[model samples]
Target: MTLDTKKNVFVKLGKFLGQFKEENCIKNEAVFGNDLFFEKFIDLIQLSQSHNGWYTPEQVYFSIQSWADALTEENLSQWLSHYDFSKVKPKKVALILAGNIPLVGFHDFLSVLITGHDVLVKTSSNDQHLLPFLANYLIALESGFENKITFVEGKLEGFDAVIATGSNNTARYFEYYFKDKPSIIRKNRNSIAVLNGNESKEELAVLGEDIFRYFGLGCRNVSKLFVPKGYSFDSFFEAIFEYQDVIHYEKYANNYDYNKAVFLMSNFKLLDNGFLTIKEDSSYGSPITSVFYEYYENLDDLQKRLEDENDQIQCIVSNNLVKNSIKFGTTQKPNLWDYADNIDTISFLSII
Candidate 1:
């Protein structure tokens, strides 16, 4: 019923999740209620791929590890320290989750509940299993959560506010339909990186993680690159060569073959390294197997251009080259305070 109570439940949940691994899963008896839920959670993480091919054990484990790190008492306290939640009045907040990657909609779900609001979640069909499993875990940890969470199977109704994530098209529909309600409606956005050609091989290799993690399915994954003119692709290619194993995944391999064929048929010049393709283009949204690139003439001009088009961008990954840019390999491991779309969900929930 209180914030500390909620935080304790998640901390215990985090401890439970920390036991699952791809190579060896170790059960921690100190974790409460593990007898009933621990093995089942491990089974769900292992079988996630059967529900959606994209949810492979490696990918699902990465997501679980990220959450395990985030739900610590120290991190949760620091994240919540910035906000004043004493004035929050309980309201039902409707959430429409996006399932492009594992746990994509979890931050919103966590924000709504941690701020003392009742959450009405409409889970994406692709991600129906994981969150509900966590919700049940939370309830088992503390029965109070049972009244604070609800999953909708049909039309959503009787909510004071809404937060929805989807494509630009679906966002338009949400904007029109929820015009009368207070809301945060998110649309498609992509991340990019700027390269001055001085990056070390290690830095560039870590950048490959930003590109290839989650099979490049997440909004935080770097989908585009900005390089100075005359930049060579040789070093960049070499740095990411280790991730060539990604091409062995059947789904990613199929996409690689299909998108590469289409590019070749269209006479588009490409820089290929077997597993990933880099194409010079002005667009931010790239296909799953490829990343778009553009050559910038001046850093200042490019900065202004990115500022002008800020709404279309989710994050920028660079070594202090762009304003508010994230460090290499750190985009996917966002802190609790790293609000999506630069919008403060906690502040939004507190006021509503």
Candidate 2:
């Protein structure tokens, strides 16, 4: 199929997704194929938690809305305009998806297919349902997609290249196994925020969205903070208090209780706010219901350190204190063009 054909299909898929927001899922009769897929999609969203406890309705709906906002004709055109597809030859790109958050791997899936390659997906067991359902919807919009998408349950093979996302441990296995193939093997990375003690309460409140969205499972979620020396946590804690309801979730509460106990037993001092805890540590990756913080003496030194250790970091959150830092509260809502790990997937695909 032509690029416009493929793009149009996704635009339709986006419109279908646009109907199912967290506030209300109103059916739009103008959307194609909704008669058969609309109600079923709603049921799937509601039941997603059964498959993965972290896939709460609120989280799933937020993901849906984000995608709905992204898959527009204008956004797709702007993102694709940077590439030359006329000379491209279709290849099979195998994707090993990570299911930590709802639809976490959708961007890679979209990238492969939108670039005119066939996709062989190995969906993470934690996220088995949502993508396939959307694939079916895409196929319904244009029968041509049926030939381009495949779900692999066994060992992945017969792909010209691969894209895999996993923890630091699994990434080693991927590198050794797919060493011969053209691949993008992603490893564990965490996001951090740099605080200057001058942020307004409103910015800090939205920063809570960055911390609590997806319960801090996404790589883009801020898991650590860099604050100035002698900076007080009073205002920061007060601003984020709005998200305390997250503690009501049993899974998060259990994590809070367990990690808090472990920290106390280890003789580590913690700053607790009844729901979330902030500990002084150097690690970028923090557990759920908690965030690690470190004090920095100078922005210049911290910038150099972050630059030198870029691989371990996913994205930075700040009031532009660091170069290319993402604004507070928008980390989880990445643009279609924002390549993960700062590696351009389209450029990689174009060469392959």
Best-performing candidate as measured by lDDT: 2
**Model 2 root-mean-square deviation:** 0.6
Tell me how far the alpha carbon of residue 302 in candidate 1 is from the true structure, in angstroms, after superposition: 0.9
What TM-score quantifies how close candidate 1 is to the native fold? Answer: 0.99
Candidate 1 lDDT (Cα, 0 to 1):
0.94
Candidate 2, residue 111: Cα displacement in angstroms equals 0.8
Off by over 4 Å in 2: none
Each prediction's RMSD to truth: 0.8, 0.6
Q: Across residues 1-352, which tens digit of lDDT does each residue of candidate 2 receive?
A: 8889888988998899999998899999899988899999999999999999999999999999999999999999999999998877999999999999999999999999988999999999999999999999998999988999999999998999999999999999999999999999999999999999999999999999999999999899999999999999999999999999999999999999999999999999999999999999999999988999999999999999999999999989999899989888899889999999999999988889
* lDDT by residue (tens digit), candidate 1, 52-100: 9999999999998999989899999999999999999999999999998
The estimated TM-scores of all candidates read 0.99, 0.99
